[model samples]
Structure formats: structure tokens, C-alpha cells
Target: MWARRTWTDGDHGYLAELYDRITAPTITTHEPILRKAPDLSDAWWDSLSTALDAIAAVANNRVAVRQEYLDRAMPHYLGIPIDTTVPAWTAAHGDLHWANLTAPVLTVLDWEGWGSAPAGYDAALLHSCSLLVPDTAAQIRHRFAHILGTPAGRFAELVVITELLQTTTRGDNLELEAPLRARLRFLTER
Candidate 1:
């Protein structure tokens, strides 16, 4: 179930969205722990991949993977020039993280940013967020190997890594810095 409403009350304008009422709470895909995480089974990962492929199949002409934006961000964020060719575009969740997903039944929330993005973007974003959990990160890479194995997918992973590293410099997710930096170095190294 999805509903979006735009309203103006007095001088304030608001846009509110009602996603599905999930039975289970959001998965722990964010910084700072609160409680035990839900059991993420292989079947759940399969569902995620299936849903992602379906979503990517949808038609969208939007330029979500903005080359100008990526090129401009790379130098400032990762301090490296992105000389690789930009990959072809496909639909993506834009902000795919563990917190946006629900367990038991797969439900991806926060669709406001969904649009055309680089291939393997959602997978890379998920992998980027799972850096703290090495096992989960490895599972994601394995599940989406076909996409992540491609040249465009590697570039997408690098882009996500750069973004994650940039976020860490701001003092957020400090624990992930070491792992992210190591992965960045591994990718950038000849």
C-alpha cells in the first residue's frame, strides 16, 4: 500500500508518504545499534535480488546517474579522478540500505528517490552499508555477483565507497572508516 499527499496548512507546505504497514520493524542497516538484528536468511536475499531486477526492468528516462555530479563529487570526496566510462542507466531504489528493508517479508520503503541510476547501484549501496558486517557484505556481493562483476558495477561500487568514505570524514560512522578505506585502497590499487 502506498499513498502520497501534498497539503498546505497556513504558510507551511508538506509532502507526506504512507508506505506499507510492515509487520516487522526496519532491519538494522544504520549506524548505532539498538537491539538484536532480525535473522536475514538466504531466501530473504534471493527475494531482494528478484525485486531489484524487477524494479530495474521498469522504464525510466530520468538521468539519475548524473555524470557531472559524480565527476564533481569524486575529486572532493575521494580525492581521485573518476576516469572510467559512466555505465548505462537503469531504475534503482537510489537509497538502498538495510534500514529501508523489512525482514520475514521483503518490503523496500522510501521510494521517493527511485529513478534511473547506474546498473548495480542498489546492490552497491547495500554492499556499502554492510561494510560493518563483513559476512553480510560478502553475501551481498555473492548474491549480486553478476552485476557487481561488470565494469560498470565496479565503478558503481567505487562511487558508493567514495560516498561512504566522505560521510565518515564528517564524523559519522567512524567505525566504518577503516573498512571503507581498506576497500577503497583495494579497488583503486593497480
Candidate 2:
């Protein structure tokens, strides 16, 4: 980012940011959806993991995923009694999906909602978005197993699934409803 300018217009506020140009195309053209998996190299995965780790290490006061939202959405979406307690929290990209990620060199875009969330929330969100591509979903699971296999990561996945399921009710992400529910069952049952 080069510069940031903020202004208030009566009751609202606006902010404009300047950033260096990204030449690489995003992994997916659609927002929050991944129809196909790109053949990414190990280096790309490593870079992404490192970037996420760096983001998680940052200190921020903003809340992207709230406790109140989790408390209400967990059991309702999972259809079972769930412990919504997140074991760990960290800074996150908040909206980490294929469309927000560039290929060849791994550039994460869209920081409008970046803030604190459950640990591994970014990976969970990315996995959820990749459900349409089973291979990609499995790759995410394998790559981030340390995070996605833990209690905190499982809860974070549940949180993301809940959010996606909620979106389905509004006629969005209709294609993801079945897989999202299946993943919910897997998470809740285990």
C-alpha cells in the first residue's frame, strides 16, 4: 500500500487506498466460489501458508468473526448441540477465497474485512470455497492439517460452514449447500 486517505461525509465515512498493481490473475473469476482447482506448485502453497502465518501474527482490534455470531449460528446450522468455544484466536484475512487470491505468486486481495478470527479461519474459509473442487479441498486439508485438524481449526471450519449455509438460505451459494451440509455432518459427528 502506498497511501490511505479517509474522509467523513456527514454520517458516513469513506476510505481510499493505493496499492501496487498485481499482474497475476486470480485463481478464480467468481467471488467466494471455486469451480475448478488450479494446478499450483508447492512453492505457491508454501507462500500462501507463510502469508497466512504472518497475518495471524499481527495485532489488530477489529473483529471479523464475533463470539455472538458463533454462539447463535453453530448449533442452528449443524443441527446438533455444539460447543462453540473457539480454542484460539488470531488475526485473519477474513475473506480468503479463490477470487481474492492470485495465482503463480500468491497475492491475497481484498482486505476490507481483515481482522481477528478463530485460528485457521482463513484456511477453513478457503477450504469451504473449494468444496466444489474436491481435489483442491483435499489439498487445503492436507496443507493446513496442523490447523484444520485441531479443535480450534475444526470450530473455525464450523463457523465458516455456518456462514456459508446462511448465505444459501438467501439464494446464494446454492451449489454449495449440499457439500457444506455434508462437511457440517463430518465436523459435528466427529
Candidate 3:
């Protein structure tokens, strides 16, 4: 970010940060959701995974996704008393979707929600957003299998699914409702 500013008017206050322009285009279309697999190189994939790993290593107190939210949301959305306790916690991008990523060269955009979350929360979020594109979703799962295959990983995925499903009630990501439910059922049955 090049500049940041804050201003207040009466009881209202606003904050903004200006960033340098990025030349690389986002991996997917304008929407944050991925509808198809992008034709990015293996190196790009490696870079993305590495970047996520690095981000997770950072220490922070900010809470992007809360345990209370997870505990409340899981049973409501999955109709099961699923455990919401994360095996591990780490920093995450919080909104790691296709549109927030750039191809050719990896560049992560949007840090507004960066904070601590479940260990594999970022990977789970990226995978969840890629569900409409099976190939991409599979690639995400494969790339992050080390994280996504563990109990912590599964719980992270559950958290992502629950959040998405809850948003559907407000008419957001409505197209993902069925897929999210399907994933939810599969996870619960495991």
C-alpha cells in the first residue's frame, strides 16, 4: 500500500488504503467465484501453495473467522453436531478465491480480512470457491492434500462450507448451495 487515510464525519468514520497497480490479470473472471479451471502453469500452482504456506506461518491476533461463529453455524447448516474445535490455528488470507489470485505470476490481492483462522482455512476457502470447476477444485485438493487431508483440514473445509451456506440465506453465492450441501454431507459422513 502506498497511502492510507482515515476521516470522520460526525459519528461516521471511514478508512482507505491505496495500493500500487497490478499488471497481471486475475486467474478467473471478474467474479470472485471460479467457474472453470484456469490454464496456469505448474510453477504458478507451486507459487500459490508456497505463498499460502508462508502466510500461514505469520503470527497475528486478528480473528477473521471465529470459533463461536463456527460452533453456531455448523449444526445449523449441516444438521449435525459436528465438532468445530480446530486442531491448529494460523494466519490466513480469509478470502482466498480465484479472483483474488493472479496467474502468469502469483500475486495475492485483498488483505482486508487477513487474520488468524483454522490451519487450512485458506486452502479450504480456495477449494470451496473452485467447486463449480471440478478440475480446479481437484487440483486445489491435491495441491493442499497435506493440509486438506487431516482432521484439522476437514474441519477447516466444514467451516468454509458452513459460512458459504449461511451466506446463501442472504441470497449470496446461491449457486453454490447444492454443491456446498453435497460437500457437507460427504464431510459429515466421514
Per-residue lDDT of candidate 3, residues 1-190 (tens digit): 4988999999999887878778999887677788876898999989988999999999998988998987888889877886778889999999998889987899999889999999999999999998899898898889899999999899899989988988899999999989888888888787
- My TM-score estimates for the predictions, one after another, are 0.85, 0.92, 0.93
- Which regions in candidate 3 have their CA more than 4 angstroms from the true location? 6-12
Question: What local lDDT score does residue 92 receive in model 2, on the 0 to 100 scale?
Answer: 98
Ten contiguous residues with the weakest lDDT in model 2: 77-86
In the predicted model 2, the residue pairs found to clash are none
lDDT of 1: 0.78
lDDT at residue 62 of model 1 (Cα atoms): 62
Evaluation by lDDT, superior candidate among 2 and 3: 2
lDDT of 2 by residue, 1-190 (tens): 5888999999999997879778999998867799977989999999999999999999999989999998998888776787888889999999999999998988999898999999999999999999999999999999999999998899899999999999988999999999999998888778
lDDT scores in order? 0.78, 0.92, 0.89
Best by TM-score: 3
Ranking by TM-score: 3, 2, 1
Model 2 misplaced regions, further than 4 Å: 1-14
Give the Cα error of residue 66 in candidate 1, in Å. Answer: 2.1
Q: Cα lDDT for residue 113, model 2?
A: 96
Question: What TM-score, to 2 decimals, does candidate 1 have?
Answer: 0.85
